[model samples]
Target: MKTLHDLHRPLGATGLMVSPLGLGTVKLGRDQGVKYPSGFTIPDDRDAANLLALAQELGINLIDTAPAYGHSEERLGKLLRGQRDNWIIVSKVGEEFESGQSRHDFSPQHTRFSVERSLKLLGTDCIDLVLVHSDGQDVEILKDTGVYETLDALKREGAIRAFGLSGKTVEGGLLALDKGDCAMVTYNLNEQSERQVIDHAATLGKAILIKKALASGHVCLDSGVDPVQASFELVFGHPGVASAIIGTINPLHLSHNVRVAVSVIQSRR
Candidate 1:
């Protein structure tokens, strides 16, 4: 099997190269209201550092986190300090989690504040990519909020490299691609409703990142099939997909996932 070091590709028109599998940090920080099938203990700072180190050693260069993902940004800031150039950090604004519930804020004031807060929490001068964390009301948020415009201004100010939306609906994803640099959508074996978003991203020369590619660990695989291998086959087969974000705190699982991703990509050749 190939390694993540050999599986790099461009992330659409963003001019950023990323591995086919991006390490997601949801599990690294948040556990209160996640959708994982089984309960998991959150890893401490040492474990987190080890996992991140293993990710880099395996050649995974993209790290996805969000303000809503508990203290993920803060943890990553501390863990990855002095090595920011080695990875592309993707984060989001407009969604805040507190007391185990999520809230949306798309106002220009909130957007600006969120970006600034992310910079502080991540201890970075500029965020690589920032996405609007949409509530289910995707179109309404795009139409009514100044969040996208705020992100555009931030990009001009050199605070963010690229911006997009982590949309929940097809219309929202399409609109995000129309106005931004990328779209993060959920696409897995059991649920392919967002395939159109991927197709559109490809056509528009924009980026698309896959979330919940393993169905949030709820996928019911066939007895003989490997879930990780099958999931990568479906996700990486799509030319539009730049990377599939897999959130696992376990180093063993991360290693397995990267290996499976490499095998899938190699098989395509």
Candidate 2:
């Protein structure tokens, strides 16, 4: 089994190699209205730095963030300036959270502006991956909006390396796989409704990233079963999964997740 220390793999056909475990930064920015099993204080700068360093040390190279994730992009900009080349940044557009409420915008104009803003906010000249944050109207947005066309243009102009959708429905996921480089879908023990999306991505040779792989901390492990290990086993068991985005602010939890991921991968061998 490939250990977490050597878990890097190609992200579909993007030509970019990424760690099998991507670190999600939603908790780094937002704490309110979140659905975690327990409350957590947002980490301070020092703590954030430590956590990032720990993630890197554990061989995680993909960092998932978004404009809707409070100040996540800004904080990552400040924290990851000198280490830009060391990570593949996956950020989203079309969704914004303001005043504790969420809103969606998939217009080409907004998509372009959002990518530009994300580049500036993350202090990077180019983003590795950008996904349209869907508002549940996935098929409609893909059909009515020019977001995909706009992102393709940006890719041609060297503003972004790849683009896709963080979509809701299986139909939307299939569309995204057909039209983009990857798809971020929700798949976990509690919710396996999106497994077809992963299967489709595999058939199409596109990347599939698992979100809420642990049921967003709501997974209840049976006796003698470790939640982290069980969750990772299920996720990584799928050949289509490029990475599982685990959002954990606690260094201990992060380390344990890494260990479990390594064990699961090794057991698969």
What is the C-alpha lDDT profile of model 2 across 18-131, one tens digit per residue? 998999999889988788988999999999999999999889999999999999999999999899999999999999999999999999899999999999999999999999
Error of 1 at 154 (Å): 0.5
Backbone N/Cα/C clashes per model: 0, 1
Cα shift from native, residue 265, model 2 (Å): 0.7
lDDT of 1 by residue, 1-269 (tens): 34789779998898999988899999878999998899999899999999999999999999999999998999999999999999999999999999999988999999999999999999999999999998878888878888889999999999999999998899999999999999999999899998999999999999999999999898887799998888888998899999999999988888899888887898898
Candidate with the greatest TM-score versus the true structure: 1
Clashes by residue pair, model 2: 1-266
Worst 10 residues of 1 by lDDT: 1-10
lDDT of prediction 1: 0.92
The weakest ten consecutive residues by lDDT in model 2 span 1-10
